[model samples]
Target: MPNIEYIITAEFHIDKGPSLVFQYPHQLPGLQNLYFLPELMLPDQIHKRNEDYTLFLLYRNLNTGEFQYLYNKNNCEPDPYFLYTIVLNLTNDEYKRGSQVKSLSILTNLSFFKNFKPVMMICLDLYFKSNDHHIIKQLYKSINEKSFIISRDSLNGMEINDISLIKKLLITSILDLPINDKIYYDENFRNKILGIGKSQIINPDLFIRKDLSFNSILNFNEMNIPIRIPMINLPDTIGDYLNPTDLNFKPNLINILNSKLSSSILNNELTIYGLQTPPIIILINAILTGKKILVMSYENSSGYIIDHILLILKIITGGGILSGLLTRYNIFPIIDVSKIELLEECDSFIAGTINPFFKNNDKLWDLLYDLDLNEFIISSNIETPGDNIIKSSIISEDARFLSNLQLSIFNYNDDLTTIQLIFRRHINEIIRILLSSKNFNNNLLPNNKDLILLLEGIGYYWSSDTTKLLEISCYQLISKKFQNLLYNEKLIYNLILPNLSNELNLMIDLHYHLQSLNNVSITTKINEREIWFNILKFLISGKSLEIFLLITYLIPPNSSTSLQSSIAHNGNITIFDKNKGIELLLINLFNFDDQIKSNIIMILQELEDNFLCGWCINLFLKNNLIYEIAFNELINT
Candidate 1:
């Protein structure tokens, strides 16, 4: 069966505005709403432009007892069925009575809609010239018949890692054939690379060798055309713009993250905010907590920002490695006021809209991101509760990773690949610590251990069996073996082993403590003020005070007094960067429970008021903690 659900064509009628002229294989459901059909088929401002192409998504609710496995076998609100769409517009003066705007769309169940672009381009060109119904029927038939297949039996024996790669890329299953180190390319493209005409039909199987690009051949209209699949595909990576030969264009996590950051959406973010109070971090954390985010752009309605934010969310979720983990979240690429009813039904979503009306309605969303102003407004009705240990660890790790990125940007050393490698090593350490326990498998059900272990081992080694490690799924985003080992070695020797003050150790130690359950004592000395400050920051960030208190208790009373006096003295032991100190103190003051709030306040009082002179004071004054402190002081007076 074909993954394609429909091949639809819509156009602007001068008398009637946009109308769905033809849809092969019958009409789609939910088209009865006359307003929505046209709005969907013709996106906002689509008719005004001479030529435009947009990639947007539509969704339908899952029927009862359907896609249960896809929804993680849980009795929860099911993830909506995705309708991936690509609308291509071209203006032609041939139409006499109607508007010149004509479009062709292929609505597919697969997220790998890029593969069908070649087919769509061909069919649209043919249809515009002849306006024949046969084009749609032929296009549909060819796509379904020639679609790539991953055999069910092959999928059953596959590891979770391989399954995730397939689900993420959603195009070609590179592991389908058993050949080693082979690159799949369309036969025609291979011939083109060799600078030869289709004169001789050499065995294309021999052409497959270790190469960077994976080109899938689309058989349409007796023409064999090659379509290059991108190394990474996210919700926002709608159109095709990847070049395999570009040095910065490799299919790796670092390159992908850097490419995304270089986008106009993130460029605007970086220019407006830089390192201080980055909206990207907040955007990431909001998605992590499953908050309803509304990214509103007044001037644009083409779902561009919607795609940008969705990509950010996907990147944070480990580039679709954890896409299944996001089964609870919904994505509305572009929505109008007509979909207000749909928005109300969702408990949490990351949606985009050009409608400014959504801004006034705080009840509609938890986070309102105004693209025009580059501002984020939190709904007053929302109460962001404190994070538990697990949530804290995840968010803190994210914070540290983002902080390191900012540090790199500040130092003019934006080596994103190295940074990504280090972060992966950090995660690998955590995985190893968890796997160290012999009873880890016993913690999960018999059937679930493989999945749990696979999830745990992502970005680390592919498999325990050395023989099968080389055959692990897709190569684009998977960390290579040599790079992985080199980075891990660099992390220990350069980052961790040399400097005890490195914040990375704090996290590694915490994971070790969690796995060992306090059995592993802290033998590493914590005498330096830098280490103490890092411990305090880590504890504050993680909301983990058990270790802090335990370490303090283990220290002698005189040393504790020495540490306190050291804070007040003008020695190297004292924190000189008062701005960072105040910022850290304020965050802890606000996020810590009421029981621990007083301790944070005392720490704040110990810091100098001169620290308030920096750019962070504006943030400090906006917080309620200062007001609370002032109110208490006034009452005492």
Candidate 2:
């Protein structure tokens, strides 16, 4: 032998046994007798009757661990012979000599062997495990292909006997095949090997056997699978997985709570005012329990305090209680309780102005009453003005508190003077906040009665100064909400119309917006003659003639002709004097045919005097003009 290498070993068991057969390559003349003749391998020696032999070659690439097969006979052959040749790679001689003979066995009963004849040929190389002569002889003797045609019931009994071993081989071989190979792409073979039938398989991991044990399922779970969960960093005060209190809140638990809260809010299970209440309660409880304490000096405390106070005000104004607090105190007592000590502990304290409205007001004071003056003094050390607090006061129901707060913050010489100035400065901010509030109504002026009272009081105090009061009131009337208030006849004539000026563009815009309101009677509030006079004044002012002409055309036809004639004559005298008269008159004549007819004769006379008659005739004739009878009469005149 040429340096005998590692032997391929395989075992096959069939119905009849104890007789071995072997095949050798043609080139190995010394082993010629070991090769079975074609007639002996075939059923009933059919090759003796001149039937062709179908040679099925199973080729394995030892270097790459791949297998493929091809048949020698062509498709035209009526009864082809089937011969299977399996190739196995050789190992190094040194290892082959030292290694023990290892065998891989495939067990199948005779019926299974016959039913799976093609599979047997395909898996031959994989079934063979060792090249040891004794092992090869033993495997060869164990497989008796001639006795493989057992009856159906006997085959069923044999299938049960060998199912475990057969299943292992089938699964291993199927899994080992290259994924993109044609053999691996055969769906029927794949399903059959995996024991899938009838219904579709859902979990591929459970393909081997449906009755897999819990441990096996767990093993599958441990295998790599694609699943993703997005991670977020939470504040340390929220706690960790082990201890789920605020001191050690788990991120997952907080995420779950947030998800639930968001779902409730989106589904409208909670009102807008109730949106932040739960988080506020959680924060307050965390502070009270000493799980988390927010420590800040008065300089930086406004953001935290302002947000909580706004929530508290909204809850109280909306007729809801701050659930866990004592009934004797209002919602914000906790601020004084916790903040005073924190403020005192800082290195230096800067005493800025806290809102004066909050200091002695009955509602807020009743909440702060339990606190000592010493604590108030300490907490007030670094108080400063915050715009958020002022904005919040816009919607708050407590007018007295808001007034007091404004007076304290601005340090005005008198309450009336301070409020008048504040109103002038923050009017836009106040109106914007009021319009954005949930309860705002377009038909009402100053929808909140509290805001109405505040403005009314300011107006009353400043009644003597009509100029300043009128300016302050103008801001309110121009706002959309206040414009809606003018739907009331008395308010339109008495309050709003008095404030509007006769400026042309402002009046135009107001007229345009007012036209959309079917409920308001515009003619009752506006003097038509005066508006027309102002519009005519605008036309003669020569500021915006196009707008003037547009407005003139919109007038009732009986009223517009005189206005158009006046405009055209004015343009003739002044614009013609400036030598641009013909162009201007022609523009008007083309744009407003009905409105400018009365002025055409005078305009044409101006054109004749300006030496533009020939130019106008040539321009019209070049464009194939057809002169109307009235236009011809104007020209003739």
> lDDT: which candidate is best?
1
- Tens-digit per-residue lDDT, 101-154, candidate 1: 667777664555655666777787788778998988988887766534321233
Residue-level error in angstroms, candidate 2, position 451: 29
Give the per-residue lDDT digits (tens) of candidate 2, residues 1-637. 1111111222222223112233321122212332332221221212122221112112223343222221111222111112222222233355433221112222221111112223333234333443334533333432331222111132223321132321221121111112113223555533443333445432332222111110011111122222111011111101111111121112222221232122122101111123332332222212121121221123222222222232222222111111111111112212233234433342221111123333533221111211112121112222222211111111221232234323323332222212222222122223222232211234433343323110101111111244333433322322333233224211121112112222243223222211211112443343323332333333322222322222111111111233235345653112211112222334334433443444544434433332123333333333333333445645565
| Model 1: ten consecutive residues of lowest lDDT | 490-499
* Model 1 root mean square deviation, Cα atoms: 20.5
List per-candidate RMSD values in Å: 20.5, 38.5
How does model 1 fare in lDDT?
0.43
State each candidate's clash count.
0, 16
